[model samples]
Target chain A: MRNTFRASMALVHTTLGLVTGWVLFAIALSGSLSVFRQEISLWARPELSVTPSDPLLVDLHALNWLSQHAGHAGAWYLTAANERSPAATALWPDAKGHYVQRMLDPSTGSPDGIRDTLGGEFFYRFHFELQLPYPWGRLLAGVAALALLVGLISGIIIHRRILADFFTFRLSRGQRSWLDLHNLLGVAALPFHLIISFTGAITLGTMLLPWTTLVLYPHDITASYADLNPALYSRPASGHPGHLAPLLPMLKEAELHFRGTGLEQIYVFNPSDRSSIVTVVAGNAHTVSTTSDVITFDGPSGKILKEHIERRPVIRAYIFLYGLHVARFAPAMTRWLYFLSGLALATVIGSGMHLWCLKRLRRPGHRGHRIVFRLNVGILAGTPLAFSAFFIGNRIFPATMPDRAFYEVACVFATWGITLLYALLRRSNHAWPELLGADAVACLSVALMGPLWHGGYITAVSMTALALSVSFTLGTLHTTRKVHT
Target chain B: MTWISLLFAQVAIGFLLFGSERGKRIFFEGQLTRERQNFLKFCGTTSLCFSLLLQLFAVREPVLDIIQWIMGIAIEIIVAALLCALWEKEHNRFFRAASQHLRK
Candidate 1:
């Protein structure tokens, strides 16, 4: 009975891994890149690469800019310049209710001529949203995470000699080697894998598992949000125009109230009217909680209207999980560590897919096997290539072109689509090396483009590109050698 | 400094854990006895615990420190494994020469 149970678990593990492994690889890889989202955004917009200045001083400039550009808007969100992101950002709702964002020079309140691009936010959002509309993308991501969790659990159940295999790795043994590596990487960082996956799932729990919210707030989901985050709740705008009070004092008061935590975001509601309220949110860099402690003030009076501190244990735990998954509170070194582990996780997923293909290759002439092999090559190799294309597009595209961000994203999908089509049409053995070699060249070009055009030898983006180039070059060499063998 | 110390500690743990048979043949040029293996395991575990404590003390934030320690260990393990795999002959020669020198 025990043996049967183990066999069933192994079957489930293999099935779950094979089914969700490709998507999980894409998600993990994007997420790993997203760890440096701010850095990547800085890379994309070279104008914002200046060293960070005092946010309080920058806020005055930002407010001046907003008064000219966004004063007539319904509401405004001003994010102060920080160590990670030096550019002051402002977002305001237009007449159409769509929020438009602009990057501002920290010193001069004018709009920085940064090219419109999705930037690193594409990866961060794509990790969870998958570029799909609304809750469906989140639900899909949550399901994929759930599958990953199940795969991990079942993988543990099947590995009888988990401890013995911890130090056992056999190189150049084909399928055996792949299995060994999959086990080694998986077991080495099992805690991180489990924590990241579980927390990721829980972070989307309200959307994925809506039963609890349904029970609590059957008629009104907005009410639930209001209860959880009362500061975000809006009051009707009064028609009477009122003179705005000085924001620096209210910001100072908020900084004092939050024990000197840096201000992350300032939200002004009904900014042009008498009932205007300003919300100052404390930054999350010092704590393992993504939900900022919020202090709201009356815009005209500058009186503290509401203070929302997340003190409930459950809510705090949820916030911690969210923070842990996002790693927004992490320092630079720790953030790099997170990025490395995320890459390791991505490797684990890729190797599992490779192992599956290797096993299928042992039995030739299977149509389904060939298709899986093609897909594995297309996705694993194609994603990095498409990402490189996106970066290249960012550099090459005209900065002032209309709807440029849309084209940037379109370039990514177009490259990815073309690569996938080529992979599916060509045989697996031919597809792998060609795509990998092309990806290597693409990466190398991106690395060189910085120095060639911008005259900077070692910007963060170029360094990242160089690293990726080396990695892809090695991958190309490995594939060529494997094919020759 | 903290990351460097954590990395060294992880490498030490990896070396001790793999000192027994497979890694010994590949990298160390010496076999470990069963008693020595047990001792190495204990030492590795203790070193890992010590590293975690050091990380906690260094960062002073429980959640962030724990994550940093885990990621640091993971990177160290990958590096150690890759080093062993890619430079096995070089490692073997170095260890063999060191052993000969020690004997002299």
Candidate 2:
């Protein structure tokens, strides 16, 4: 019975590793790239930087323009520019249900004419959400994270020499090199792997906590969220005729009153109504909560209405966990380290799957492992190739296309789906070289055309992209040659 | 579950180290003779020291801290035993004794 249980657990571990392996690889790879998200953003739009003045100065002017344009409207929102971004953004509801977003010059408050670029934000979004509908993608990532935690635990169990094995990489032996690489990467960054997986699970605890909530609170999720963070609340405006005080004066007043870090964002509620309240969120740059005391002002009078900050330990702990995951307040160097570590993690997972295939192929009568082998090839090689195709499409697709981001995403999945199909139809051994080669070509194409297409060329970022693409392409080709010989 | 997983992983690490050292002498000279205990002592002592540092980190989380500390100590004890066995030049005999004990 114990033997049976052990086998069952092993089966679970292997199955989970294979099933989520590709998604985890994509998550890790993109997460690594996202570490340099801000730098990537600057590279994406260089024209925005030609201005000499601080973005904050322009933000105040833009606020004045917006306020004048708003006329009798209750409130206006201004998202100030910082180092990662050169342009300020303003958002307000304009009779339509959707928020209107416009880039403003920090020096002039006029339109910056800089095109919309998601920059590293794409990887950040893709990591947890995969551009799928919010709840579903986040939930799936959470499940994968749990599986990763299990895989890491089981992987150690199956390996006999975790440390002496560290210095033991026999590259001449076929699958041995891959296995050694996988184990070395895993053991070397063991702390990060464990912490990231655990914290990832915690960040999506909302999906997991429903069972607890159902058992204890009769399935009241809203009440649970409220209980967890009570300072957050929403109220519709009471129907009445009134006016809002000038936002510029209020902004100046708040800076003096708060005497804290720079402001994060100004959230305006019910901007058209008399009861509209403008909440100025001050930045807590040193800490992770992204929380500032909400200094609410009556829209009409610009009078200070309410000020509150979430200071409790439990809530603070939750924010810290999330902040680490998001790198919301992290310095640029930390983000880069996070990115490199994430990339290495993806390499670990990818090489691990490769090791499995190489091992099973060596055994006699390998029919049982064939299906797993084919699936691993399809997912591991196919996902990155598909992701590169997405970026390539982003540059090549006509700008006039409606829902460009949607189309961009569709291209990615379609490419991936086709790669899987190809893997199934052709010799499985061809999967790695072909898909990797294709991805390399596609990424190279993006790197070449990025300056032409985006009109912003920073030598460092472009060179990095080109180097990574070439390295991936060349590495796969080397493996293919090695396998053949 | 987190603590359990961590402990399980660390145990695997210990067994893995023990298994890899099989059929290999501790020193490069390749005889089974157990002279030069300095390297062996350093290995055990350094491992225990790092394990203690890891324990200090583990203690921040109350429920997991004790479990982590136990696992760390257990792994250290295993390492010490393996080192002593190597020093005593009786690891094979120790393995033989264990297998016989299991058979009974």
Candidate 3:
């Protein structure tokens, strides 16, 4: 019985690992990059890398401008500013009631840049949705996460010496090295991998478990939410004629009411309405979750009335879980750690696939090994190269170009597809070095071109590229020498 | 009393069951085996007793639906085995199916 169980566990691990290795790697790599998604956006568009945007300062200027411009319109929404840009953005209903965001310089109240530059939002959107039209992309990502969970379980079951595997890594042994690296990373971060996988799965559980609602409550999911918490769906009315009270005063009211330290977001509902309320949501930064307790104040009177910490437990739990998954409360250091860990996860997936190819190449009957090899090259090598190309396109592409984002995405895929074709056609012995060399060259070229293309110059970006290219060139030389020997 | 408490408790029970099962198999495989078995039996019976209580408390049907679905199958199997064992005690003339077949 024990032997049978052991055999079954091995089978489960091998099968699950092979099936989801690439997808897992991609998800991890993207997620890791997503931790610095905003910073990378700044990197991509070096043109916008100047002066950090402060919300308080931006809000003051934006409110004054919005008050003057929004004559007879509904309440204006100032997009909370941060370290990304100095422009303040406001969204308000036009004569047709459609929402439009206008970007204004906080100090001057003059228009600066277009509101929809897709800077940081590109990463935020790509993290879950991959820029694919709603539901489908996010659903795909969620399903991949579930697959990753299964892979994690199967990996634990299959590994015979988890502890021994923890400390072992082979260098200069080709496939053995790949397998060792994969095993080492997987075992080292097992707990985090498991929690991250499960939470990520549950984060999308509502979408995944739509059938649960169908079977249990056919008519009303809304009722389920209400049973959990009535305040979950409440929103303030619009079109009220009232000036918003100062943010600091409302923030004080929230701190006094919720008994929390900092404020997260201030939602001004019905800013134009005389009865409109300003809701300040207090943020407890020390906690893993930012399920804020809100204090709503009358916009005109500055009188605080409603204080809501959502009384229902289940609803609060769900909100907290969601917030934890988003990791909004994490400090910069913590985020960087998470990002590096995610990079290791990406390496695990890439190495696992590489291992499969290596194992197959040793035996004679594995005909599809070549295909797997090409795919690993295309995905792992091509993704980072594509990423660098996006930066290049962001700089080099004419600003007047229609749909600059669409063109940038096109450039990325074009470079990536070409790299894959070149990898497949090139000799197997030379392919690894060649592909790495090509990517390094592309990165370096783009890095150098940044100054030529855009007036803004980043010494750090250029230096990083130079270092990467030197390493890749040295690696290429070493590989060629080994092959000849 | 809070619904979040119940959710945490459910997760805790799952972990506890897994941990106890592992402990019994690994650390205490000798004299304490019977005690471990009895503990598991008691947990099973207590879970059955609280089935009704669980249904009454959590307002959401989906939550109840899932809980009942998992627990109902477990409870049914346990109750059936207990009944079968009691019936075997009463019917001394009748041999169990597997034993009678093996005798042939």
Candidate 4:
């Protein structure tokens, strides 16, 4: 009976892993890159300055820009400049109710020299959205995360020698080597893997498991949001035209009161009205909780009407889990540690996919390895090729080109599609080295182009790109040698 | 201060791995007695606990510190394994795999 149970668990583990393996690998790899999202953004737009400027000046500039352009907008949202992102982000709803996001310079509201591109935001959105339309991508990512959780648990049941595996790794034994690595990387960081996967699922909690919200507020989702976060203050329009108070000083006051560097989010309801309210949310950098302090002001008077710091224990726990997913409050060393852990997770996913192909190819009467092998090369090796192309496009594209952001994303997909086609055409033995060699060259070109700025962020990005090039070169040589043998 | 904790943690893992049978066989000829293994493990355990306490006390944000410690340990283990592989030399699995490939 015990033997049967173990066998069933092994089957479950294998099936789950293979089913979601490719999508999980893409998500994991992109998510790992997303850890340095802000730095990547800085690298993409070389026109921006290195040293961060005053938050008050940026906030005022954003406010001025939005008031002139999107003044009568449904609402204006701004993220004030800070250490991670020097340029403030201004977002507002258009007449069509579609929101537009833009980054602005503090010196002048207009981005005079900076090019329009997704920057690190592309990876950030792709990890969750897969570049697909609406909730479908998020739904897919959520289900894959949940599947990963089950797969990890089932794998633990099958890999019974947990302790020995933690310290065991033998290279160059083909299938056995892959299995040992998969087990070692998985078991070595079991706690981290479990926490990261579980929290990934919970981050999309309302989407995956919405029964509670359904039962609680069956009629109104907006009302449910309100109930969930009473801290998110809002008010209705008075419908009378009124002059508004200056926004920068008001924002500074709120920042002072909140004890934070910059306001994370700003919501201006009923702009240009007498009853307008501007609410600001800033997460506490002092703790590992996503619980933010909110300050709502009377828009016309700029007087603080309401102040809310989350005190509810239940909300605190949920936000804590969310906090771990973002890792926004981490200091420099801890942030790098987060980056390394993310890479480790991505490796586990990639290696698992490769191991499945290896085991299948070795076994007699198994035919699926042929297609899986091609895909492993295409996505597993090809995605990095696509990333390199994106960086190259950012460097080469015209600065003032219209609809530049659209083309930047298109360049990525086109490069990725070409690699996929190449992988399908060639035999696996040749495809691996060829594509990895291409990836190496692409990375080298981006690095050799020179640092976008002399600032720490851009320099770090250049160094990282150079390191990736070296790693890819080594990979290409290794694959070539294996093929020759 | 954080580096101090990291140093201790690395030393702890280094001691623990040095005491293991595989580590000894790859570097030395035979395993030590059970008593010696226990002593090495005890020292490792003590060092690891001390590192954890030091990290907890040093950082302003204890949560971040604790996470860094856990993540640091994971990376160190992988590095240690790779170092062991490199030290395996020609008479071990590296050459064995090579010979097998040649025969095939």
Query: TM per model?
Result: 0.92, 0.75, 0.68, 0.94
> What TM-score does the predicted chain A of each candidate obtain versus native chain A?
0.95, 0.85, 0.80, 0.94
lDDT of 4 at A427: 94
| DockQ of the candidate models in sequence | 0.42, 0.05, 0.01, 0.51
Steric clash count of candidate 1? 0
TM-scores of chain B, in order: 0.68, 0.34, 0.33, 0.79
Query: Predictions ranked by DockQ, top down?
Result: 4, 1, 2, 3
Chain A alone, model 2, TM-score?
0.85
Off by over 4 Å in 1: A1-3, A452-458, B1-4, B24-31, B87-104
Better of 1 and 2 by TM-score: 1
Candidate with top DockQ is: 4
Query: Which of the numbered candidates is closest to the native, going by highest TM-score?
Result: 4
Native interface contact recovery, all models: 0.42, 0.04, 0.00, 0.40
* C-alpha-based local distance difference test score of model 2: 0.64
Quote the lDDT for A435 in model 1.
96
lDDT of 4 by residue, A1-485 (tens): 23688899988888888889878888887887888887888788878765667866877877787777777887888876777787877778888888877788867765557788888999989998999987889999999989989999999998877755556677677777778778877876777889888989998877798899889888887998776666677777777787579887788888888775357777788777888888888845666777567888899999988888777887788889988877777777777777777777777888888887887787775546788789888998888888788889888889789878888889889999999999888999999999999989998888876654654876677777889899999999999999999
- Residue A250 error, candidate 2, Å: 3.8
lDDT by residue (A1-485, candidate 2, tens digit) is 13665566667666777789878988887777676665655554444554446544666677666655653444457776655556666776554445555556666676545544454567778888977797889998898888898988877776667755543443445676677667766765666677678878888887756588776678565787656534334467777755567777777666666565557677666665778777776665655555645577777789887766667787678766766666656654445446556766897898877776777788885765787787777887787777677666666666545556567667878998898888877677676677777777876776785553443335545565688788878877885896697
For model 4, the local distance difference test gives 0.81
Candidate 3 lDDT over residue span A280-387, tens digit each: 666555555556466667777888666667656766676666665566655554465566566667777777777767777788856478877777777777776776
Docking class of 1: acceptable
